[model samples]
Target chain A: MNVEQHHSTWVIILSFFISFILAIMPLPDWALSWRPDWVALVLIYWCIALPQRVGIATGWFVGIILDVLNDTLLGQHALAFSLIGYISVKIYRKMRLFPRWQQAIVVFALIASAKLLGVLIHSLFGSPEMNQPLFYPALTSLLLWPWLFIILRDMRRTYRVS
Target chain B: MISKEERKLVLRLIVFLFASIALMLTDHNSDYLKTVRAQLLGGVYPIQYLVNWPVKAGQSLSKNLNSHFQLLGENANLRDDNLRLQVKLQKFEDIKNENQRLRRLLGASEKLGERVEVAEVLAVNINQSRRKILINKGLSDGVFTHQPVIDAQGVIGQVIEVGIFSSIVMLITDPEHELPVQVVRTGLRTVAKGMGTVNRLSLLYLSNTELNTSIKVGDLIVTSGAGQKFPKGYLVATVIQVNPDIGKPYAQGQAQPRSALERNWEVLLVWQLEPSTVINDEFKTINSQ
Candidate 1:
């Protein structure tokens, strides 16, 4: 498959927007409590898939929007997202060589790190504390990574768009 | 060969970090972020409405189906109950009229004012840490900032942001929330603060010695109006657990919120009442001292 470089940017943006919509979608009460951070998951996937064009800067911008959208402390999600994006980009070449299952485990660790960083940043702002539910979404995101990767990978291949 | 764009990228990251620092400082120093929030939410609400439509419709369909069965069974039951209630209501109407006459004779203040508009909850913050919910009404529906929200059960929260078609409500269960309440049986006033856990709140700064006061496991707690921000007598919670230690200055207790705050699909926003402009002659005489 010939990968056209320019179209990959649009693919990334479109996927990110869909992730934002998913993140905001209302879920059933029990399900919502465990809903993954779809934006972060999508962003990380794109960073890994097309490392040359999408990087920390893109992640940071989306982070700011998510922070505003969720109304949390400024820079909480942005900083975490950018840092995670940077890490993924740094190892993208090696990651592309790994098996799908291995990549999913690595993505889980990255998402988990971002979640912890978010808590650390918010705590610096003196917001009231919460229990483990705040961290559960990250793990949930990791568990969804393999499926998301498979679906998105096929879309990129089929559309000839990517 | 590495391009100049690669070098520029490092500079851009530094710039973004610096910008974020400035934003953090500005958001901390003033209410400037509130305007940004309002504008962003206004723009995104249409998208939010689209995303929520399917879920809202599904919920409503299920609710309608469930109620339809009950409606048939309840039709005859409600008719009989309605007749009995009509008779009882006549007695209440007479008492209410007589009470109004006595209150006017004693120059008492009227408590219930104009009715309020009710709104339905459309969505909740996907991020659990923020603890915010969105309602279907916005500024067009007369919802303004800090308008108190209540359900049929009790106080829920207050409107914090208004969009064109929707408003964001900061729930009382949110970690940042604190409401002043009093024990109805003991008249002991204290501030109830959210623990960010469901169905629980802890009374802060109450003295241990006061634990002996008539406050009990089932004592009703209502807004004290001591802070005077919220109206008085709105149900807050019921004391569920109280523990006192001999040496501690305060007793620890928990409350089950009167409202099923986490599950309710609809809430009402209480509009603020204007204070009486007429000064009492008795108050004028006392102020001279």
Candidate 2:
């Protein structure tokens, strides 16, 4: 039991690390705005799978690291991710009972809210007008959810992460 | 009744949200957290470098795959370009000496040649509204905030934030950026404002009331060195379009920046010739004379 717990901890950390790398990878100019929120999606998955262990605090920490990497206003991603974390943890039980497609829709709504929060923070800081296309990332994240969910779920079961 | 676990979750969320707001407020309002931000960015530097490694490897791999004939052609073209530049340098050397002699006769200080350090581009901001790029050089490399950055073609931008091992450059095409420029043909001074377009800059403060404002399409614009932030006479942009708005006090003009702002892999960070105060005093002396 002790060995399993230790392995699961490493697995969770390794997953977050990979997500961070994906989040910072350079994208072509035309596809930049369409880049998915890899960190957020991963954080949501962990929050759902390990609600007791991963929650708002983990999200806040990861979000702050992302802000540092992106060189954006501090706490902007932190706030958004924390909100996503809270919502996911709140609904994780009911969400797990739903079909995979329904769960993906929930992920869509969660990520969309996070994007909205980011836009709100940017506007509040008096950033120049961003076009409506800023929401492209949320759409891409939604499309990627099902595949990511299946992969992560299999990994969890195979490793007995809980 | 709400469960204890739910209540604790709500409480934790509130706490984190409040902390986030507090952090955002402090970051936006002042420079108090600049040190913290810089140190945190230092931690992120290694990860960013690792993430960028694959792209760099791919670029080199493609270069190595080029045919020998193509390599020979490229080498020959580079050699020809070098010879042409050396011929131009000879003329510049003579002109520079004459200019220095004239300045000495006028009791004016000689303008020193700028010292530059090279830095490699690491990442670019994905946001279209914020035209920024991150480079590998930072405070440890003698880079400082507001240092002018240029590529071989022309001025690209200025360093805005310096981390321990990386820095952010705000490109000339950012909407918030403005630089003083002078027309090469007519010597008319004007402020060039970034138009959020890579190739174009807008000339501001040009009053239509000024009769025969010599600015026209295809006029060359260079730095005026007004703020002493940019060295004097660097190629900035060229006027592409000029339209006098009917009944308006100001005319609108657009210019294409000389720098290939978005494409360069390496740039030079230039240390300004003189401090702002010293430059201001020199300007005053020149004007009084």
Candidate 3:
């Protein structure tokens, strides 16, 4: 297989930039707990779409940026995103063959597990018992996956980004 | 079966995970990561500004399109408020001078006022669990960490992170915060802790003896100035509930914060007069007396 090395790296970087914005955007109090994990969703899409170019390292760095952005414990999101990136990369081929709805379920599991990892570490650090909204973002992310996939797919094709 | 690349991937993940946990541990247990966070905050400043652009645009647009009648009413209200404030300012001048003279006579430090700067809240709900807000003022504006924040009503929070153009204020309602507050009526000094929610603070370790007797519902709480963490006598909260412990040493009570913690837009950052300057003022007042 001939690999196309001419990836529009800026387009990929731009998508991640927008994801970072959404992650930090201010939300109303009612919606605060339900704000979807934008960075995680975008990273997962890139890992699966261009597994060769984006993977564990991309996810890890993005997580660090998010930790700084949200002022959370350092490396909390890093560890979670890295694991999800690895999983997505490993299953990218098989995931592409699955139906869209089936794909959403797997995405939910990936993001939810990552969020669970975050909750665990925070609990270790003595954060209060905030378990109810633990899966809200994951649920929101699951609902968003279908639309996001199409939007990002169009972006990828339009810019011919790997 | 794991292939060669897969093994490499697994090894990389393990190494990264180990490194991050180490980072988290260090950050949790010490202040070493603060410098790193401060440095990275400059890079993030632009991103935050970009996200706030639409909100700022909307505000300016509304201001520009205000109806003539609405503007006339707003101007009248402002003029009315200005006249009332001017009358109060004249009396305030006399009281400040009298207070300074009394403080000099008592040999206490003059602590009447602190210089303050007003900042707009740029963002809120930075994290769901931690109660924090980002303000438009930051390191460039000489904002230091741990500086107290307040509004027209009362205490809001303190600066936790200072970036190039923005700073994060941790509200008193955050689970990690503990404010030393004094009961206005009984002079009972106790620690008011965050209940992990807005408008509510838990006064911890209140003696059972004072419960239901001196510390009751509707009592006012203010900063005790303990540990010099916060300025003295600022309104903090008001007791909303007092549940006494019959046999225990302490009673559990709740207070509502005087400030609108969750709805703040414009906040004041206090510039506490340093002890050295305060001492100098004490000497100057003494010499004059």
Candidate 4:
């Protein structure tokens, strides 16, 4: 497999846009409250998959878009996502060496951190305090990570540089 | 090794962090971010509509099915239903005529108030912590910020956030939400606020000393019109619990709002009268006094 076969910047951008759509879909109230931060999760997967190319800048930009769409105070999500992306890039080599299950756990913690960061920022601005359903989405995303990785792994295998 | 490229990446991180901090500060504290918010939301609108396509389809399918059932009923059964409806209509018209005659005798306005536009609930954020719901109405649909929203049961919520195609409502059960309510049993008025408990709310600072009255369970509560946030006479809730203490000046009572607040299909957004006129009218009355 060659690096040239990997998805280009444009392809990643389009994929993120598609993932954003999935994130904002009007799921039922109960289901929506539990809907994992889909775009962030997807972005994290890609950032880990291709750390050299899509770095903190990509995360910050996409997070801004999410903030705007959700009508949140701007840059709140941007800061969280960018920080996670930076941390992921910094540890990409060590993270790659970890077992896949361990990697999923790391991703779970990182996503939870991003969500808590958002809650903290909102609360500081006098928004009413909300109980954090922190563990539910974290656990669900961790459980789903392996299947998501497998599907994307197959895509990478199919599009290898011959 | 801290290579030059790595240094550049670190520099990028610092720059972005600062930029994000600046943006967040401006967004939360200043009025300048609306232009940016508008532009970003405009860019995202196309994608939002595309994502919302399935929701619209599901709604249409349900509506079509309902109409189909109405169309497929037996003709004889329909005829009998029409006759029954006609008889009821005649009685309703008679009552309406009597009401109008009585209103004229009293020199009352024929129209009670402003008309309402019906809207559908498109999405709801049930984050128990931040209780907000979004409906498929916008400025284009004449929905403004702070408009009172009610369902067939009663006052469901109020519009707190508005966008181009949809508006978000903060429900009465939301922790930050409060409504001025009057006890129908005794005409005592107090502010009712969400207590962060589902199906429960508390009336704040109700002094039991002023009026030696006992409030029982199942007593009705209506809007007090004290703060002018909600119109007078709208049903707010019913007293579910009354805990009175002999020593305390105020009693802690709980009421369950008339609206389900959690689950409802349709809601009506009430357009309030313009505030400037209300303020000017108040000024005139104060000057005369």
- Per-candidate DockQ vs. reference: 0.45, 0.63, 0.69, 0.51
Deviation in Å, model 4, residue B2 alpha carbon: 3.1
lDDT tens readout by residue for model 1, B1-289? 7678666656766777777767777776777787776676776776677777787888889878886769888898989999998999999867865875677688887543334678888764646655678888986777778778888778887787777678888877777888999998878888888877777889887777777775779999998876555787789999998888668778888888999887887788887554232224325655986
Q: TM-score of model 4 relative to the true fold? A: 0.77
lDDT by residue (A58-95, candidate 1, tens digit) is 88888887876676766667777777777787778888
Model 2 TM-score relative to the real fold? 0.90
Native interface contacts kept by each candidate, as a fraction = 0.42, 0.64, 0.70, 0.60
In candidate 2, what are the lDDT values of residues B201-232, reduced to their tens digit? 99997777542668888899988988878888
Docking class of 4: medium
Candidate with best DockQ: 3
Query: Any runs in candidate 2 off by more than 4 Å, and if so which?
Result: A1-4, B109-111, B123-129, B273-289
Pick by TM-score: 1 or 2, better one: 2
Q: Clashing residue pairs, candidate 1? A: none
Model 4: CA > 4 A from native: A1-10, A21-34, A68-71, A155-162, B34-56, B59-112, B124-128, B208-214, B245-249, B274-289
Interface RMSD of 1: 2.2
Best-to-worst TM-score order:
3, 2, 1, 4
- Range of the 10 consecutive residues with the lowest summed lDDT in candidate 2 chain B: B273-282
Clashing pairs in model 4, backbone N/Cα/C closer than 3 A: none
DockQ of 3: 0.69
Query: What is the Cα-based lDDT of residue A66 in candidate 1?
Result: 82
How many clashes in each structure?
0, 0, 0, 0
Q: Could you give me the TM-score of model 1 versus the true structure?
A: 0.83
